[model samples]
Target: MTDTAEAKRSGPNSPQTAFTWRHAGLAAEFATATDGTLRLVRLDRPGSTQRGGAVDARSHDTVAPETALPLVELTALGHGSGWSGPRFTGTAFGTRLAYRGHDSGSRAGWEWLTVELHDPATGLTAFVELTSPTGLPVLRSRVRLRNQGAEPLTVQSVSSLLLGGLPSPDTLHVHRARNDWLAECRWYTEPLRDTVADIHVDAHQHDSRAALALTGRGSWPTDGHLPMGALTERDGGGRTWLWQIESPAGWRWDLGERAHGTYLALNGPTDAEHQWRFHLAPGGELTTVPVALALGSGLDDAMGALTSYRRAVRRPHPDHTALPVVFNDYMNTLMGDPTTEKLLPLIDAAADAGAEYFCIDSGWYDDDTEGWWDSVGAWLPSPRRFPDGGLRAVLDRIRERGMVPGLWLEPEVVGVRSPIASALPPEAFFQRDGVRLTEQGRHQLDLRHPAARAHLDKTVDRIVGDWGVGYLKLDYNIVVDPGTCAPGDLAPGAGLLGHAHAYLDWLFGVLDRHPGLVIENCASGGMRMDGATLAVSQLQSTSDQQDPLLFPPIAAAAPTAVPPEQGAVWAYPQPGYDDDLITFTLGGALLGRVHLSGHLNRMSKHQLGLVRDAVSTYKTIRADLARAVPFWPLGLPGWTDAWLALGMRVPGGASYVSVWRRGGESELSMPVQHLAGGEVRTEILHPSAPDAGTAIWDGDGGGLRVALPRTPGALLIRLTQGAENDHR
Candidate 1:
């Protein structure tokens, strides 16, 4: 059934080529090939800065170096050519790197280099890239290695590359960790109201290694590698699959839909973790990461990308949406004190006063004993907390008001104080001494075990089915061992001792069962947020501290921790002047999800009114805000202004803008591409302050002009018809 090389090569017209050095002493070249569809490269010698002397090319085996040293600089390139060989010439950078191009049919080319190092034990790397005849990047790479001195060495490394691709909006990011069909692991936002975009969409496959990955869009809820949508073959056999790898390498991504930039990076794994992490002796050590960027249509295309690059190219994918705005309220406050008599009224008031979603937090259980990680799976009413009891009755009460009902659960967790742990054998624990430690406070559940599997199934089935919970905010204050865990189940990228991926698989499975259900995956507050797990949850807890001031740091760091889809942010705003409210909501909106855990009933009547109005205004433009093009308007020319004008433009050029004034005077303008490069009339309006109401005709200068009062915040503006399409 396998086709011979000749048979496989016949369908397409291939290119032929070899390497030529234009500037000799400056750079040395070794291998090269060109075919319109295939390219190969190897550098026997590169620039002084590049690294490459002895390398291990064996598929899954380690190799050793012979002497005390090896040149770190080296690179090569290959491509499919129209003719067969020798029509490509190259340019060299000193004696360090070189690049070549063909003057004929093929419109592709490459540049290679051997990056050097100061410390011998540190590491070495190579940089390579793909270019268009017009000189735009199609792909780029950063290959690396560990200099083991004169001895053998082993290590784990990851390559981080940056690409410029399509902009991110309301898109999906998949999780690419391990899968444990048996474990009841799942994902969601840690903070109930902070950020809710961590929602991980399962491709419905149970193969842990075959899950979705984050595309690292915007900065919020989380950072590092956030999840993106899943990738199946361009066909049905399930041969080719793809996922995104995201990071903050300081590159801005703003490509329109049909993105057509050069490929940035495309490297594969040296070992299972997409890298090599090892050691070095008195004279030995190695450190490096290889990134890769690849594309193919068949199943083989997917597998082949993971293979072959074990020792070659390394690249990072482009970035996406980086929103930082969020909504906040006293979500889990009810959980703090489950006494329904006093809490229900408060929950209702909060819901009415403009809170996005009311979180029916914890504390409804019968136990004063329900603290921390204790009492995990006892999904029942605490006779002591609500003596009159009916959890559904309370949930129904909330939903009747036209707002969604969000409930909190810990499916992957079980407390020792609860009946579930005492019911199961203590031997089922993850081992403290040998008997498996079961603290009187909390007993950990081994998700990788069959016993835990059955337990989670029963719990999730009921909580999700019978309860009809829309948002499941699950928390794991403590890390649970993912069992002895199967292969490909380590905390990806980090390769930490915990079976992180195995747990991720279980989480996705549960998400697949509940329709319209949002999963909030959290780790002891700020812990567990990374490239792997972020992609699989709707939202994750960025931090446990809910202070208003802490927001900026979270927003700043968010871009580096998780992708935009999971960029939900949890904030506890200080209730004061409407300025803080405007500031909090506006800032949070710029980031991700926003949440609150304070008393909503205690606010001033004016504050409540303001909230009611903000929520109404927010809903009016929710659709436009949710899926609009994000463009930020600059503040006034000087003096510490807080009011911000965030505008979103639609395809045909219609625009929606929201402005929040903090302290200083507010005056700002936005420029648009509407009006076919000509002039048009503009008008602005706001319920809280002055309404410039439909007015004069002027060109598309500084968007619609806006002005705000000192304390009254949150101004909204809309732009309709404009100039020509090809006027510019």
Candidate 2:
């Protein structure tokens, strides 16, 4: 099951293949140059050969020193900067690393391969670890560096993964997603040659100095872009490489032309981009953030593999499978102004609508009538807002109505005017140059400090343990740019990295204490949606747009960035809205987590019936969501697309598709290759009314034609194979 071999040099001056590992369908080969520098020359699925064919046997000898990057790229304070390029290449420390040894092992269902390298001059040892699930075409990589010398080493940049031997730029295309407040996961594809232009390398006898780089800075990892990307062959070879950087803070990935073909560098916070530096004393060690790469025949296949990898690595919890429905009084209902008088009736309405949990979002702790945005450190109930038995009374009503109580919390910040701002010591908050860092009237808490962590733990325990709350909507509304720094820290970015890790640790601690509690991750609505946070949090709020018509694209494209069961899409139906609008909003969330919100207490019985019907339908199909793999029949949704479609397929069972007609024609046809050549039985699962929409399955053509008579209508359709083709 485990295979490994070491390559020996044929001659003293010739380049040698240092090591080769083949496991789980992935083959990786490391080569050592004449100078004894180690480089990862090959990483590919040998069984599924591409049109460009395997890498040349003599590429290790022909590749230029600048392009033949080491297996682990390390840049230190006193190292040689780089070659004649803007890229992070040709570092002296990276070039000096020589292959030491390697090992392979298997545990449970996962296999791992570790390659060790050493730099004699600085006594820096690098261990490159690569892991993957058995029989999967996916690989996760991370690097750990140890300083064994007498002198201290300050690391400015270290790559978690460095890959070479990709196809030429002319035969490749790149895909990346742009994200923002209301617009999340807007993906665009471009030719790799356009981003990293070919400067006639053959004529110049050298590779181009330019690189196509994507960098995310600050605490919001996905503020401007998602930490995910893909590169596919342009010749219809179906060779695709999809990758995701696992970090809650700053990260960067770049693709550029190298001597043999192309090279990719994935790293966490770096000195040039995020002012991050790590100080490693003698015998000290540090590990870089992990990154994952999945190879497949196409984009969808690669994404499916990546999805499985994501599900495998995340913290296991019942919430992922149970997927309980949540109702919050914030989106378009109370709007951060919740009171017992306002919530009691809403709680009853939510329970009647089958919401498993009811969360009183925001402003619950504010005694002031003006606002609670600025003064929000201490998470306590407001006596003026709660009255009589206080917030506990509203919670009791929710419990009485058959729903668990929940609360909103922003545990990382203290308002400038709040009492906790002064109660906590200055060291407990982020500070630089002896001054506390403030953003939008709030001071960021440095979770690395014991006082700040203890305060958060106390607040969470009081809310979850004492208050009997089962859900917590954790929201972060402000951004702390550059990062945080202290007297002993190497840089602000380094301090931010430490705080990010510490924050995750605190989250794990909270979950450990309260195993049944569900936490919703919200950072200004999807700004902090990254692999690292999604792996910990139970659910993710897709957006805060508040407009039902504008939410279709966001919900449709959310699965591309998050798992379907965890992407919480809001369904807020106002009393004045029609049945079509209600169904349109609710149908968008059927394939994902249903986050119900609205003025349900003020609606008529007829309107309330529509809401109840949607919830009932969600429950029927919710069990299949945890095992489904998402697909887009009409391709990734465009922001202005008149027709948007999201499909979830559960192998050997049935497939569910949610289609929305925003402002286009009456009919839309999309390809469904999996159901081709088979008889499919289709039915409308939501709205419960036959006249909501119409669908025609073109089994012969492997497509589905849908018609929504209304302009802004949506429908959830289920497709099950006929008995004759059930096994197919």
Candidate 3:
């Protein structure tokens, strides 16, 4: 449905309805309706600073305008009235939006802009906040809605943001990713015309409007697809814009065409499609999930902007810079079955191999029973598995080897058979209609309740304080379906969203209390990986794919969604594997957080030595890892790509490259963006013993020729640009 009605413009000097907020190259202008509906007038590279001339809604004020958009559309449910229409009326734009006011500020190196709007009839106020680090070409947005009416209101849907007037709607392409357990981040780029029927060829000049939406439902936040999208002009300016909904719950974003141009709409928890609704009483307020938007020259540039934005918004943690090597006992070894004897040797071997943290993943609290999955909430150390002095004996061994000891915890759900299920008050758990909501033998906790928060707080404190544990692997393994219904005034979606906010607050509170503790965020691996969780957690487990051969693409593409320092990719090198296979597995992690695993204790001395060498190489390049931007030499990796490459450009003129050869040519030229027209020298940094391969810099082609004699091999190279005389 396209609306061709043009929006009325304000005066030349001061746009009564429009306001501009600028920060260096990026500028955002917002238009407000007399009824208080807010619209994104312009968001793009800053154009001219000239005054207005009928304010061409299409062109920015600047002479060399980037991309300019019209008012972003809104559609939602109204209390007494029904659904909101395409155009705004005094009280018709869904609950009748009204502009209140706006505020802006800057702190440290970040700038913040907030706009306030409300619906007087419904007494619902919406506050939109945009935050960005100074000079960064991206911004993060979040919305807060408050109900001030005398009666309760049912908010069916609300937008995190809506941007319109995008350039070249006809030639636009949408890019996003499809995610599953093992095959995560499988990205696809398709033309908007192809996805929407409106753009199909009819030889007519009619503006056929079409819409395409990407959404994620339920608790496995990223189960079906990533809450992210991108739009690029295929034949026009070629400028690309990307966005991510930083929500761990239901989220939706729509790309559509209207009379003005293309538009992008971002929202969290809707009633029409996602079964999400909220009941807001007088004086009550609910905050929407955050959404991040980035604009750059291309996909890589936009991704780079998002990367920097992720780093800026995340909670400051020492672990980000420390970049420690972690040894987990789950993949290729242990596999959830752990014992004192099995772990002691592994801990000793991990320490000797230079692992900084040793995590006893899963099965730790399980008794020797076949029904461990359903009987899991107590979190107590199993007497049978740790017959000799309990689990602490092994923890002591990990500390004795100078490594931090960590434990795996799936804290969100409690098993029905577990004693904790009945121990806690009924009000602490999620209840629908009158029954407690249970899924797969596990019950979800409503974090908004005091008792639920207390239970989790006690668990974390007991483990961190009494046990002297310094690291935690927090995992969430279940989906809560649509949501939990609040007992009285709230709907199921609102109740679930409330719990989500409280859960993060609890996580952050845990961090505030245990300042030195490091938390690794995992949800069956990479499923719950979003900025909201990653902002508070120290590291993110990229995936749980056990096949060494299939992990290269996942590890390589992790940086697209997370920072390299926080992307914990598993590097499990087993004894049965050949030297080439070991290098392939270990190489996958060298560019990101090196999460070391596998049966190192069972490996031969020679096999263990290779692991040690890889660890040493990681440590040398880790300092640069903290302040590096990722670049793909062979483009984004395919799930089964023959060759994959990831480059990290550091502060200095040097770049670190990690390349994997699964089943490709012996020699392939990989391009390096930064070293385009300069004389550069490249050196292999890993597999120092047996000749793994070599890299030769080609300044003319602006790339490096990498040659590996054997297939299934890998190489890590450091590239530095300098003249022959300037070289050491």
Candidate 4:
């Protein structure tokens, strides 16, 4: 009975079995062995903090605490797993280290019945290791996922790295760049209560807050902020990721479990569509996602040591956090099922108005899209609606109009009436009683099967190669799909999500082949705007907040707006609505993607001018603003409201700040601290206001406060060095 046992399933009365553990070289790293587990303490550098914060216009008090990572907590980390089915009972080598994991349990999915060994790092790296796939230490971890569930199962799962100890006044919040859909922050605030209340993920500032009974409730990915300070060790700076592996349905989750008030999480592929459904023969082995953990640091000086920790071995330094935003001009809804002929004028006008992309939407291909679920997988334009030359002619027209052509595809899904459904090998679909069930406006297509993958790949080649599509809008809305979890490899309980992840994997693979080709993921709006989708596309439409006229202000005001750091970080103001009001409201959303959502032709001349000017102004600050950080005066009284100041600090150069006002007052002064520091001067250039000037103020010591006029609550201030004052 050594710490490293070679035990196996004893058949209730047989010999004990143990998993194998292998260790490699290490200089000063500590390796502690417990009853059946090992801990690799990676000593590293202290955490780093976000340097800047938004300044004030009315009063420039001390800045709010920027992001910080305290070091003392770095020693905290763990690894273990709850047994949904059978887990390894013996010691096993994973991520180059040796550990143990238990197997078999009730409520099998969330069961922690058996034991689990771990080589948990200080929240710096997830213990994503199975037995080595290569040989010993240089690279690899090979392990297996055993499914014990009845019926065919597919396993698609997502795990988050949880960290605590955060910046006050603001718990960690991450919003979709567009909608008010908030995602669960890895950190739980209410000390763990389980109540499902709706918190806006990509919400307007006024709508982002939600009261969740933190303990028992797992908020939907679109209702809460990203939990900040969830690192296992001290926090300052470090990187983490969510990872997953899919089977056709049954699977197990591994994690470290000790109740000393620590942290854990799953990063990287946030919503990889990996649910629990895998169609596994009882006691059968399924494709495993055993050890797909994160790598990062909290120990400042130990960076070099941690960097060479081996687990991060040949992994690429990928940018997983933020994605770019896109603006699409073509409206896609059926709009009461208008005919293409009736829509041509509107579509043509949108293209002429400088729309970044012009899509034919749903009606372009046929007269009836209400039954669109039937039209999918057809891959051809209907003759009834598309008269003489459809897609080809449209492509030519779009290119001539100077805009990229984007086409929509739902490869992971198929319509019951789609011609290809009957053509597809029966294995390509999710079957129940010889019939495939459709859910949420679509039917699921399993992605784990090679045949399925091959089919999808071919479709992309044909569509992109033949149609000359610039962008691919991958709309995923399947709710009952038994997604691909490797051929015959299903997770334990993945219902529709299992197929979802496999489907995403398939699409991402296709995207990889098309260089410079951007993807627009729409899980019926913002449902699929997970990290996986974010990694593949420039931007994702946060929601179906498509009505330009009514949704502009609401779009601009949702609370779960943007990640504090990236784009779509604020609310997006839809077009039309109230041009001036929308102008002022769009202040906070300089980061992430912001696109128009209504008919441009309907706008009055003034509205059109307003939009053109707004877009122009956005271009002017495109480098600094567009998708950068802007500010809103929170905690202010209503009506007697104030203007929002958009400022950019130019490194070693002049900084520009734009103020958009909506509330009364012909004028108001804003503090200019977000701009370049040092001895600087301010100049006001209000294009519409007659009163303006280059005012010389003490810009040092105090923040840069500018006086802005009414109507637009607009003010543009440029900060430049007053001279060569070396003292900052």
Candidate 5:
């Protein structure tokens, strides 16, 4: 037997059959040998010239007994006890048993495959589900364990996904990111052996346990580390495998060498790692968190496939296509201190600058006191802030100016001094030991309770239905440390997971009832940013970094985790800034959801013109944004890059590029992937300064060479398909 086996299934005697699932160039083949030996025969983008390139081709299982690999790598309790990789322990149970049949089907552009395995001794049946969309190069997977026997079973750990088999183990690079408070999505790519191989050398010395793992803990989904990672074949043909855990609780993924091949195992929470354990009573079941695995020829291709899949999974909303420019009175403006007098002029100025939605962010309900933070939860108009005609007058003024009115609401928590705190019983809040949990002077609301849901529904309906507010900026400020413990049965972490799901359910219900309303998800500036939350919310606040200079990198890297149309990038062009600075700030947001802020009312007529110009440019490119895929000219941005570029390529042969020159060289060259080896007409769509920069198409290098004679400049370039692939 050879590493590259011919495309064929196992012999008739083998109960293990082959399943070759594919979408375009991407293909994943799984085979179960006659002896219940399951192996991932293929997990790569098959070459176009390969025979049986069809997505539905039969699996190629030709590995000998010595080379056969286990379908699952990790074992929980008694599951997979005969597996080769690391074993995750529990009270009892492992997957050392025989294989059951499988169920598979396809519909609505998606195909689902589920394999069942039973540990006859413990009567614990495990089901593994793999789902992939028609055009996406990715597959989503999760594991479910059911207790079929009369006795209850205590489970500790379960693999969310287990994938074995890759082309090679030589020189494999692990690509991941280290995320933090202000700095988010900073990526690092290193050798797989360097990251996890040496961590357990003593235990994995002469075995297939050379493991590398990445884990995330706490309530903030991406607070410690991003829920995404990638593995690339350094010496092989640019083959890349990417995975992301969409769980909000503790999650981990491991890459290891096993059975002359490589394997990837992903899971969320375990009794061994996160003190997470659950009891599955007779006829009860539990499921692991969802994880996505993608295969592609290159990083960009893999990321693009994931991006397309994201758009398909997100909750459809008009805001996605409309791409309305939002003006929020917070950053560089009111700063959570909005008043009737202060907002009236800004509302008028925002409408003049073409802002479609004017959001009164924060302090709108605060009764002109410093203790407002502890007095929230009661979403009512403040008499002191709106002395003359109340908040309705300001909201009416916004509608009169031809823009939708939006309000800021932190509905997840109630303030310690909030009237609702005593109004609702402690059962409506998160409790550990009969006492409500409080963080940062805020009490976390458990949406699993009907009272909490009713409180929020009433507040939102009053503001939107009664006052005609069409938008809501929902913010989550504090992290619910540890988690809540249910009275007797559920773990604290399990309680937290239930509450998170219920919160999202409430959000979906709001959208169901209010079909025309738009909601923005903000968590003290992207702390709670994840696909699950974004699926329900209309927009994601990229960050809360007030400095305009530090915003470009975040905006540039946002598309890796979020869609361009849903990523609300703030463009705060203040009256005090020069023309170039204003344009630089505005350029950071031109390619994403333009979130306008700052003191627009105080800006001069000339200064206001820049805001209007950027808004006008946004309107022109917005329609293209809804259908665009992101591309990076200079690769992913670092914390401080002198030159950063983000490109959005639409279906047609047209593309838009936003370049920011923080402060460095006058001339810089960036290679555009789409325009490579072709000539394209390039023009600056939004010029930050009168003499911003000149973009020249370099045919020889296959890149757009930009020359900016001035420092701190920005340019939005439009590249159109050229006549002949010419060079100048």
Candidate 6:
């Protein structure tokens, strides 16, 4: 069969299939309805028979125009009539768009399919582009709009992707994650029927106007909710659709019952939600943010596919392959109060514990005796903190001990009291009504300005080039809501979107200048965790929760949104903690990037030995993490669960599991169904203490029974199937 197949129309008013394309085991069909609207009629496995024919027949008999949604839903001012029902759906211009043509081809490592549509009334053209990695059951989509008419157009909302013809609402379950400052990546599942109430569509002959919508506001894309969701069949059919929107600015998604089945719409920013508007001149064009959709038999399978897609799209860097252990002086240790006297011993201790990079986080640039919170624009080291030879002396010591040196930097914000705030022109800062906007005593920088970009470039060159720093922790601590608007922009959200694009370009330029340096993305920790930011940065700080007892859930759920190798989980073992407590904290980071912290120099010999052992074990298995996919044996974790298990399925049918016991019974059972009916061997990789914990493998039942004698204990276990050599 050919790669692309085109079907001709049979009659003027008769329903006809327009196109059918197949790739990576999935088939997509586009059909023209009786009213001449091009709709995405079906998306399913290649060999599977259609499941909702009878329902679709009934839907056509009742409401022919609402059977399926168009390829793209666009809302523009003064171009189309007003829409009824929900705010973003059923736009007159979108429904009346005429399909021009479609083409398919391969470029680089991706296979792409583009469908073109034209708005005859306004002379607007939209190219809906869909691409996927070769042989991956994942599709990413975005829309490019060009204004070819005489009059200018102001677009209010445009969907990146619209998927229709899903399973019946009564048979589906929706999953979403809620994120906060201390609590992050907490997922919950609900029935789709509950969200979109049944309004007797057959009796009323029209679909419901309400929708189950989720929106993220402000510059922090993932501040309130993650830009991801999934819909799985409640019955035993085992079909799931998991999706993510790739944007670092405002984003919104909605799903509701249509005439034939449920439909999903994913978008970057809309006027109703984020006050965003885009003005297109006669020759101007705009491209929407990209969104990805993966199909699988279950949630885990879909997540694994998404993991592969993420790796395929990310910027190539050595940090992903090396998986080096980094030690930062912040969490529960220096607490952002770093000095030469305080960092010397910690640097030596970190180097002895198998750490390859040491970072001096925050408070390093406090030349004033007063507080440093409102006066942190100058990226220079404090002379008062390092009296003798300056901060360079401490960095030299770190390098002398066979470790790379790093520093903490918040590049997008200038403190209100900073001299740079006044030195730079008003255009360099984010301003509204000719006044700079301040949040938490810090002014946001408009990276779209040349002066602002130049300032950051000079700072990065001096630190990474002249100072020889090899790593940077880029942190953003303020939230600039609605965002900043210039004179011609329609709204603040539009300017914010422009700045987001500029910021990403600036990041690429910095990496081009310093290719070897590693950058870690942080926003008070995990606030800005999205695909766009993660694709450019090497690592992501998962959270800032200082309490070890409350961190296991965050660490366990990090991989669902972030790849294991890129999610930096902190393991801070303090001096006052016992051996079991130390193991508990260290175990949380074994499967992911080990962000080691705490004052190891203050610990005794045995405590230090435990830290060293964890680092060594991580080094042995870190190579496997680059190719591994994560799984949860006991399901997505609860915030206060007694026991939590996170596993990584590596190549050669081997897996590594990290189990944490916070409270309740010491004995717990977790099901690893994939390894069932196979002979398996389990070994404790860390602590090596014979009495720390015991794990019994049940090959027949595909379960692992763990017994930890203490209330707060943890274990890192490696499970290998039937005669496979242990990679570690």
Give the Å error, residue 688, model 5.
6.2
lDDT of each: 0.38, 0.85, 0.77, 0.37, 0.76, 0.85
TM-score of each: 0.52, 0.95, 0.91, 0.58, 0.91, 0.95
RMSD of each: 17.0, 3.2, 5.2, 13.1, 4.5, 3.1
Q: 218 in model 6: Cα distance from truth in Å?
A: 0.5
Encode model 1's per-residue lDDT on 1-728: one tens digit a residue. 00211111111222332332212111222231221211222211223222111112222111111111122222211111222211111111112212122221122233333322222322222223222111111122343444424544333222333222211212212113211111111122111112113223244221111111122211111223232112222113231123233221111111111111111122222232222223334354232322323322332232223222211121211111222222223332343565667667656765776664556655655465536456556677666666564667666766676555676665655676678877766544454334453444566565556676667768777776887666666665543221222233222222212324445667767766764566665554544554345555666566554444334434323423333234455534334535445444434433334454445566666656655654455445544433343434441111123544444555455565555555565554444433335554343433453331222323535345555544434444566665422110
Which 10 successive residues of model 4 have the least lDDT summed? 67-76
Q: Please give the lDDT score for candidate 4.
A: 0.37
Give the 10-residue window scoring lowest on summed lDDT in candidate 5: 50-59
Candidate 5 C-alpha error for residue 523, in Å: 0.6
Kindly give the stretch of ten consecutive residues in candidate 2 with the minimal lDDT sum: 4-13
> By TM-score, is 4 or 6 better?
6
Model 4 Cα lDDT, one tens digit per residue, 1-728: 11222323211122222221323211111122322223322311122132111111112222211111110111101222222222121111222222333333222111111223323321111232322212111111223344333443232322222211122212222111222333211122222112212343335332212222111111123322221121222233332212222211222222221111112222212122223333335465533332222222311112112212221222121111222223343443334243446445545655544455554444344545466656577566666665657657666766776767766666677777676777778777665545555555445666666776787888888778777887776665544432333344333134334554566566567656775666665655554434333434544555554432233233233222222222232222344356445454343343324454345556576655555554445445545432232233221112223444444444445565555555456444555544325566555432322342223345453455444444544445556767532111
Give model 2's clash tally.
0
For candidate 6, the clash count comes to 0
Model 2 pairs whose backbones collide: none
Q: On a 0 to 1 TM-score scale, where does candidate 6 land against the true structure? A: 0.95
- What's the true lDDT of residue 17 in model 4? 29
Q: Which lDDT tens digits does candidate 3 get at residues 618-702?
A: 9998989988988898888888788889888886657888889888688999888767988887778887745788788878898
